[model samples]
Target: MKPAPFDYHSPRTPEEAVGLLAELGEDAKAIAGGQSLVPMLALRLAVFEHLVDLGRVSGLRGIERRGDAVWVGASTTQTAILRSPDLAAAVPLLTRATPLIGHFQIRNRGTVGGSLAHADPAAEYPAVALALDARLEALSPRGARTLPAAGFFTGMWTTGLAEDEILTGVSFPVRGERSGHAVEEFARRGGDFAIAGAAVAVDLDGAGLIRRCGIALFGVGATPLRASAAEASVLGVKAADVDAAELGATALAEPASVPSDLHASGDYRRHIGAIMVTRAWRRALREALDA
Candidate 1:
């Protein structure tokens, strides 16, 4: 199927893009990369009178470190993040998660902002962002504001972005020297969307006690869910004494509100979610110890 006819507008700056959105109101949609939007358009799942292309927007295309955080422009491609050694060092969890997004072809054209805005429950970036406590920046005719990742995702395929706002960038707090990260996911094929996944980061004190930790799970909820119970279970515990896998399983022992789709049952997804968390926790623990 082909997308319905629509007016297209390319904006060279974020201000111009937001201005177009403000003027076009609900009739327009901002597009970057188009990996997700194109498919939705082709299927008529989404229709827009005007399509605002943000590819030419200069403000949304760079990766830089700002103070203790790393700022990634909304338009920055997944491939760009995968190739940046500096970025990997600054935020290892993001680096570990990017490769799991899709195939090389999709990653080449997929943008960070695009994925976040698409808000797929199984998307890797959303889980990483939630785990790392990243901040999403947006611009509108009224003004600009930053949103916490926790609140940015309202539900599956939905976000806090207003009709007249354009996501400008995302900022992730830099990992300390003793911090380590890992991403674990299960998919039927190499490039397929994960059935269940976990993104984790941990910081250990000199004595090998867990000082801080973040755990986020995907493919089993309406939005990427932070495993707050799991994180709290490991705090202040000696890394060597903690059975990461057991703790992970125990944390998610209770049934959760997960979707039951054709690909897998809700019970199966919940089981996989626990396994993913366990694998990611163990890997992250090893990394923290090595660091």
Candidate 2:
């Protein structure tokens, strides 16, 4: 089905974009890349009176390192991220997750900011952002504000962004010398949305004891979930001594709520989520020890 009739706007700058949103009110929406919004519009799942396209907004399309954190512009495409060697070095988990974000063509058009703002509970980027404790920046008529990843996602397909706010960029914190990251997911077929997935990051001390760790799971809950309970289970323990199976179970042992849909049952999702966590934990452990 075709989308309903709407006004199309291509803003030259962010100030112009947000101003349009503020003036147009809730009926207006800011669109970037069109990967998520376009499909929804076509399906009649969403409707907007106006679309303020950011395609012509030059200010929203660059990747740069800001001291310790890697800053990625809101319009930065997924393919651009895959091609960035600097991003891979600074935050390998994001690089690893980018490949699993649908097909190459989708990645070519999909933007990181679009995915985060869309906040699909099953998407790869949100889990990665949560795992890395990435900071998201949103712009509004009020001013710019920074939000921690933990607080940004409020529910499935919902975030902390206000009606007139635009997600400008995100900054992923850089890990120390002995840190390592991994992303593991389970999909019925290649390029399919994950039934369950885990993004894991670990930091090991000199003697191989766990210094710190972060685990974020997707496709099992309303929002990308941080497996803090499981992370707390292994603190200061020898990396090799932590059982992947037990840790995985601990990760999904208690979710706020596991989604149950035609794709999979909640119990099945939890089971698959545990297995993904185990695989990711084992892989991250290897990388951390090898580092």
Candidate 3:
């Protein structure tokens, strides 16, 4: 298969990229890593009259700290995130989850913003973003705006980004020394999309009680599912006394929400979702205790 014929524009800056996007309107698509979009193009799943390449957009690539949050340019590669000591120290959940994205080769070419924009339900980045309460920055001809991770993902392979907008970067809050993180996922192979995955971050008080917790599950719903109910159930509880099974059950209380696909049944996905959540929660609790 081959991509449909299209005009290609290589932009040197984000403004230019967005400008091209705005000018092209619904006929154009902005590409960063092209890991996901390229396949879509080849299969004709997505077609456009123009392709706006942002690879040369310098402003859209880097990792830096702003106030209490770390801003990662949309073009930052998964491999870069995996090797960034600053990112690992500031947001360990991201570091823990990056390797599970695909294979080493895939991660080498996959961009953070590309994954977020692609919004794959089984993707590690989306669940990590939701768990960390990250913010996505979008640029358009109308100007710029920030979107909370919670509302950014609207459905499977879908997002709130307007057709004329380009994701420029993402911001993640710095986790303090008292916080711990872990990622748990189940996949058939090393690079396969997760059947069920969970990303967890926990902050502990001096007394070893869970002061705060963030839990996000992927491959279980239309979008990354934040287990607020499960998180609430463990607050003020001793980390050592937390119940994985109970928390897992709480996270998937509505079994109907789990999707049934060729890989697994709804009941099985719900079960796997619970198991992943439990493992992530317990591992995070241990890290918090050790911290």
Per TM-score, the best of the predicted structures is: 2
The C-alpha TM-scores of every prediction are 0.97, 0.98, 0.97
* Per-model lDDT: 0.90, 0.92, 0.90
How do the residues 187-207 of candidate 3 rate in per-residue lDDT, one tens digit apiece? Answer: 989989999989999999988
Candidate 1: where are CA atoms >4 Å away? none
lDDT per residue as tens, model 2, 1-291: 999999999889778888999999999988888888899999999999999998788778788999999999999999999999999999899999999998999999999999999999999999999999999998988999999999788997999999888989999998778888999999999999999999999999999999999999999988999999999999999998999999999999979678789999999999999999999998999988888
lDDT of 2: 0.92
Name the lDDT of candidate 1.
0.90
Once superposed on the true structure, which residue ranges of model 3 sit more than 4 Å away at CA?
none
Model 2 CA lDDT for position 261: 95
Task: Answer with 1 or 3, whichever has the higher lDDT.
Answer: 3
Better of 2 and 3 by TM-score: 2
Q: How far is candidate 3 from the true structure (C-alpha RMSD, Å)?
A: 1.2
Candidate 2 — worst ten consecutive residues by lDDT sum?
Answer: 54-63
Q: Across residues 167-272, which tens digit of lDDT does each residue of candidate 1 receive?
A: 9999999998788889998999998888888898899998889999888988888888888887888899998888866866865564367788888888888889
Best by lDDT: 2
